[model samples]
Target chain A: MNTYIEGILILAGINLMAVLGLSLLTGFTGLFSFGHAGFMAIGGYTSAMLTVKFHWPFIPALLVGGLVAALFSAIIGKVTLNLKGDYFCIATLGFGEAIRLILDNVQYFGGARGWPGIPNYTNLWNVLGINLVAVLVLANLIRSRHGRNMIAIREEELASQIVGINVFKHKITSLMISASYAGIAGGLMAHYMTFLQPKMFSLVKSTELTIIVIFGGLGSISGSVLGALVLTALPEVLRSFSQWRLVCYGLAVIIIMISRPEGLLGGYELTPSSMKKLYNRLRLKKQAGKQGLEGGDIQ
Target chain B: MNILELSGLTKKFGGLTAVGNVDFKVKKDSITGLIGPNGAGKTTIFNLITGVYKVSEGKVIFCNKNITNKEPYQIAEIGITRTFQNIRLFKRLSVYENVLIACHKNASYSILDSILMMPKYKREEKQLKLQANELLEIMGLSDRRELIANNLPYGLQRRLEIARALALKPQLLLLDEPAAGMNPDETEQLMLLIDDVRKKFQLTVLIIEHHMDLVMGICEEIMVLNFGCKLAEGTPYDIQNNPKVIEAYLGVEG
Candidate 1:
């Protein structure tokens, strides 16, 4: 494959990692966050510092980056996850902007000037491998009792509590796991681009991640993966349109939202069993149509 | 032995008292009914007992333990679970999943165990599935296991809520109007089902109901609340004969 296509694929993989985490939070848990880019920033800077300043290995640094992001999310989640509904969304918006502005003044990692000379360790193979593990782990977690509790909390929080689920604890847990994913994604992006800037992890980046999740469909991992791949490549595919590419991208998103409000897959999964069920239903419909035609001929 | 005791229980919202200085004792393994007109604070009492609202001034003693002002989940964890006045099944989930989510507390496998698909996770999960299926079977929802909860008939939705509560293996079950939207035939079935559940689970039930026939049929003891105060408490016969209870239900003679 050409380097251009390979680069886009790698970018899509990184975005998929973050979208999977956000999918767990927004889709399954019913919590909306607009501060995930801040997590990416923390991970990016932490991992970059480890590799550049201390000469640490790539994978361990990435894991440490995710851990740091999870730590920060735990603190923020404790303070704001108690706020119900849109209040939590607003809190995360403030948090994302705050992280960016704080990073702007920190001179240790090149501050507003941006950091360069980061090793190019984020190859397509590593990205693919990491994303595979992420997806499997996420799929397993969603199918478990813990995942069911999160979905229960999302569906009806009061009922979940009445059913013996500790809602607050589960909310924080979702937030922390989500942040860790964003953190790892950020580390990958930093190494891939071989550069970092506070501005790169702005509110827009966070909004983009959220949009990808919603566009994919809530409560479906496969939808997030498809969404990440399609959405990340759309702009690059439209590059020939020049400055109008973004306008075209915005139009495409609006069209999808209007046409399918529940999202591309809604809450349905694309597993083998579901596919088989769909196929059987279609075959039965076809058989019924044939029977109707035969009855018409007899008439 | 009494399974639950409320002494001087009161809940004041600003100056408006929802449940005021009410006291009652629920005998162990007995189906106790709480009934009154609308706004009589029956649901408020359920909320207070479940820790949805903090008590203004009262003591809620369950099994000789003072559990007043605990979190709702904590109250549930301590073997007290409730069904809402409004049927609050996880609406988008399937019938089996609705009950299975409640069965979560029974399994103690960690998140790591689940994500990594450990042997312990598989073993516990298999057990939870069996338990969920059994509960669904008992609730008569086995055939509709894959149906979304919101799509179930109103009466079955109510039944599903009770089944979900039972999944917690709660010692004391507080049911808020399990027969609200149910028809006469459905109500009759519900009465039998509630009685059967109580016997099978060896549960102590405190129920709030507006249906006199169902309440009178299954409840061994009844507590009447009028404007947040205890109006009367006794057997069905005693409560039917009480003049004050009659006056409260049907206005005093003009």
Candidate 2:
């Protein structure tokens, strides 16, 4: 029972990192990245090979893996972010597949047979510590001036530029940050699983990260955290109806979209004083109108 | 000396010449109006000056430097800011956030310093919040500072757009069709607000507006464009009486 609990923690912590990374890119910056799993592969393979071959320490190996992913992201973002909207998304999807194919066919690092003996060094404490750092750094980044500029760009690029935000530069910086976080997530994941294969970092995994961001509203940091937690737990809770579990999940998604499309948060944010303000506003609306609820502007 | 000088500025969309070799100057510390009916290339001229569209010919001199081909951000960095005709507020961000984002550029904090939360970033961020609140107060939107920008009333949205532009501390401010779709009372209030803002900021203001009363009530000088050419340029009284300007507005397509 303890081992099972540990396994779930490991999965949740690692997935929290990856999905938060996706949230920064697709959710906050509105970049629509589909290459996170590719960066994850870079992190996973690089850290795994370094540890197995060179016998490097865990922390340094993790950093190197993140750097490698960042390098790839910078190159890809430089070319593809200029394409605008869905073009960048599709280009990233291609990039993810290309990375996977290259990894699968490679001569070294065990190729398709996968890399083993990765040494499961990521325990609950390590997982929690790393996830803590990820959340802290992401929260700070979102609150910084760059984060505000990113929100501006995401809302309206032209207005951002007219106010002197170099949109392209900000986009690349954001992509790099997101890529590095994904890389770290992958490294932690590789250690937790004690092995890795090229197939593990697939387009489906990338879609999963994007779905987390979508489940949470874009531009809402708390939404990302909540979305990751719910998604990680919901499947386990539905295991009794094993055959219908995925169907139930799919139905929940549809129902949420059909009923309230802006997402669970509807782009509404939770800052310190906002809780009080929200209560006050809800009370005011209830008193003013005969209706008990209102779907105010989501964006 | 003029604050912004455009010489021989032309724009071409395929074979059609949208704006043809227009020579224009906007002076400092005064409200200038750019007025024309639809299809007169009034908005196109704004687009050219602000670097939204590249000029096919000639130079744009801002504060005595040739900025003909600079990107919009670069132009804005030199202290020229503009608002869109459609009111391009950052819709997803809070009204306060929209203003603070513009304020970030001028705050004296390095990127590394901000990420590390140096005392400077905290101090600046707080100051920026205060400044944003004051600006919102000036625009009568202090109560709605936390509201998502797109949710603001139409008149309040326009004021917020101006507030965001003002956050940049611009020397030259261009407002495109700022009085669009406003009732007479709202337009009158907007006219006073524009004057108040210009006086308070010591700003060189240029507005593209369709409201004749708004233009005549406030603008010291007005430029009328017709078919991509300058039809009239004078004080408000002269513009109201100019034959070509009147004909351009009233007798177009005849």
Candidate 3:
């Protein structure tokens, strides 16, 4: 593939990594977060420091970055996960902004001036490999008992508790896993761009991730994959329109939201079984139509 | 012997007392009825026993353990589970999944085991699935196992809630209005189902109901609550004849 297409694909892969985590938190666990970009920033700076200052290997550094993000998320979740509904959303927004401002003041990582000379380790193949692993791990987690508990919490938190689910612990677990994904995504982006800036992990980036999750459909991994790909590529595809690009992007999002409010997939998975079910239903409809035609001829 | 006891249990929301010094005992393996008028704090009492609300005063002892003010999940873990008056089934999930989720307590596989699909995870999951299916079968929901919970009829939804609660394998089941939206025929079926479940599961049940016929038909002992206080506690005949209970329900001769 050409470099331009490869670059976009790599970018889409990174977005997918973050979007998948957010999907688990928001879609399955029913907790909305705006601080995920903060997690990415932590991962990006941590991994970049490891590579640039300590001469660590790329993969290990990325894993450490994810771990650090998970740690931060655990602490944040401990404090804010108790807040209900919109209050929790606001807390996460505050957290994301707080991380950005803290990074702005920290001079060791180049502070407000931004960090440069980061080695480029992110490639299409590695991005693909990491994302493949991410998807597998997520899919496995979602199918497990733990995953059901998270979904239960999402569906009815009080009922989940009544059914013996530890709601607080599950929420924290979801947040930690989600943050680590964001952290890994951040590490990848740092290496790909070979530069870092606190501004790159701003609230807009967080909102963009959330918008993609909503666009894809809540509670569907395949939807998240399609969403991250389409949404990440849509802006780049609109680049030829220059200054009008954002306007068109916003308009397209609004149109999709209005027409398909439940989202593109609407919590439906695109698995083989579901696809087979759809095919069978369509065939049955065709058979019914043929019977109706035969009856009409008799009449 | 009593399976559960609430002594001087009082819950105050600011100046208002939802349940005031209400004391009761649920006998082991017995179907006890908690009957009262609206806002008479029957559900509030269930909430207190299940640890949904912090007790302002007094103790909740279950199976000879003081379980007052524990977390709801902890209450469930210690062999107590409940259904909501409003039927709080996981609406978007299928009937099988609704029960399966509750059966999670019986499985001890770690998150790592689940993600890696280890032998322990597979074994536990298979067992849990069997348990869920068995519970569904008992609840007469086997045929509709794949249907979304929200799509089920109101009566079935209540049954699903009970099945989900039973999946926890609790010794004591607190049911909040199990026959609320059911017709008389459905309510009759529900009464029999409740009796069957109690016998099969070896359970102690504390039920809150407004349906006089069902309560009178099924309850061995009935506790009446009026303005958050225990007005009467006796067999069905005694509760029916008690003038105080009568006045509490029908009010003093206009």
| Candidate 2 vs 3: which has more DockQ | 3
Q: Stretches of candidate 1 above 4 Å error?
A: A295-299
The deviation in Å at residue A223 for candidate 3 is 0.5
Q: Pairing residues by index, what is the TM-score of model 2?
A: 0.92
lDDT of 3 by residue, B10-42 (tens): 999999999999889999999999999999999
| CA lDDT, candidate 1, residue A267 | 96
Q: Quantify how close model 3 is to the true structure by its C-alpha RMSD in Å.
A: 1.2
lDDT (Cα) of model 2? 0.86
Per-residue lDDT tens digits for candidate 1, residues A1-299, read: 89999999999999999999999999999999999999999999999999999999999999999999999999999999999999999999999899999999999999999999999999999999999999999999999999999999999999999988999999999999999999999999999999999999999999999989999999999999989999999999999999999999999989999999877876989999999999999999999889989888644
lDDT of each: 0.95, 0.86, 0.94
lDDT of 2 by residue, B54-155 (tens): 999988899899998888998888889998889898886788888889887767676577767889989988898888887888777888988988899999
- Residue pairs in collision within model 3: none
DockQ of each: 0.91, 0.64, 0.90
How do all models score by TM-score?
0.98, 0.92, 0.98
DockQ of 2: 0.64
Q: Assess the local accuracy of residue A41 in candidate 1 as a C-alpha lDDT between 0 and 100.
A: 95
Backbone atom clashes (below 3 Å) for every candidate: 0, 0, 0
